[model samples]
Target: MKTIFSSLFLAAGANAIITRWAPCCFHLSASGAVTGTVGQLDDGQNRVNGPLSPAEYCIADGAITDANGRGCILTPPTSQWQCDTGATPTSGFSVACDGTVAYNGGTTFYECQTGDNGEANIYLTPGGTNCGEITLKADGCGSCPPPPPPPPTTCPTNLNGNYEFPHLIIPIDSSNPNSAAGTSYFGEVSSTISSIFNFDIPASDSGKTCSLIFLFPLQSQLTTSSFTFSGNGAIDFSLLSGVATVSTSYANAPSVETDYGSITVAPGNSYNVATFACPAGEAVSFELKAVGDTCLNYFQDYNPSPIGVYITTC
Candidate 1:
């Protein structure tokens, strides 16, 4: 054993070249675990690196007390290394990294950085630090808490506006008089139904009578489902294109517009708009039903009249 150690010392001093000066070998100290880069003497070779801690003689000091030691000195690893003390789950025990830089309670995974080409790797103790959970990359970020829940959903706003329907003919059913039904008699005034509001022409009838043109004042609203509407309409008792001219005072009411009709979603949900058409040879068909609140109110007063302009168009 003495001869072997002597040969180790001789080999380390061979680099000195001048005098037979060998560094003073470490006198085995009592401190069991000395910290810092105090080179380890192991595996049959004399070693020294950036002065792996030498209480007596550092390699920087030019000569050791006993020519370094009889073993290879481990230099801190060459590859860049990092530690990731994985996030400890909220309810579980802390999963930490060990003194060797490996993580606890998980697989030993070490990810390589952007091109770890031509580099040496050692995980034990890179840079003389037990960086647990080693990564070939410098960034040591690890698993994080789960992402926060998504924000709650919210209802969207609707567009409030008006819908205009131009030139629509609405026909009112003339047979259903409120109280007094109409009969064709020479003296008995025929049932006279009148829409006071004039649309461009006046039905100059001696008594208030019905006309063809209609004006629909509509309102629209949006709902959670889709869309809805409400409207009140008046048929113009003015110069209906083909109707006979009657010079009547009721047809001359300044504001002859009557709230006689409404537009609402029909029972089948398809009645979105109130429609009108003057089909050839057929009396203008206009759906002047007492549909909504306003329409029902107006029809109440304008009912059971002595004159029924028996036109099924509102």
Candidate 2:
């Protein structure tokens, strides 16, 4: 026998009862709580006192029924509608008692109040007819969904300003994840942070990256590891122009030195400006671009053809 169940918050009045019409002519094989109201399987099944009521609703299509019998509310095959696992198992739906079926073999309930109260024929309801349908379990009650997941956390970085390009930092935003980015301090990049520097150029990647920072023609620092470079120049605010001469050294060959002349050119297609966040006083977001011989060769690694940059820019 298949069955379904629903929870109803029930409070027994001084004199209250419940009823459900049998689906068809069916026998009431007394098993569970309905034995009292049912009286017997073949004899005294469908009969009620007070307002026919059954708080917790359940279904059990029995093997028998009765035609003229309005007394067959309590039919055979019983099952309990247990509550869902929670402090309260009644959330999304409502509970109702239905007994429209006359006698064939329908649903029923065991209204166990403080009274010697007994069984009653009643199926669980979403509410009105043709509303919804549910399946019943032979073992335990039915099922429902679990709770919901939590919200995501928020973390913002200070990066808001019009930053011109003197360098370009490119990180591989791809499946391989070979993107490169770092902080660049002016002059010889020392261990400690200095304010005399013009601005730091952060690459497209993160972590302690060392690059030459020249505030035009003064101040410098050199941190250990990787290829290191630093130099200085002068930018006349009045003229808005400057020349920067930079020297380079590497961890493999620290003593060797190479010079790279830096200047502002038209925004080349090869160079991509990237933004960085500064967690400090008045927040600052910078888009820095510095493309020179020191970085990767655009023609070989990225574009594959030098003509692309020339033609695209032209």
Measured with C-alpha atoms, the lDDT of residue 188 in candidate 1 is 12
Tens digit of per-residue lDDT, candidate 1, span 1-314: 11111112211211121113432222111111221222222222221223333322212122222233322122224322221122111110111111111122222322221212211222223332322333211111122345677532211111112111112222222453332222211111112432221122223322222223221212122111221223442222232333211221332222312333433322122122222332323222222333223222121111112111222122
Error of 2 at 234 (Å): 22
Estimated TM-score for each candidate: 0.14, 0.17
Model 1 spans > 4 angstroms off: 1-77, 80-143, 156-314
**Clash number by candidate, in order:** 47, 56
Worst 10 residues of 1 by lDDT: 87-96
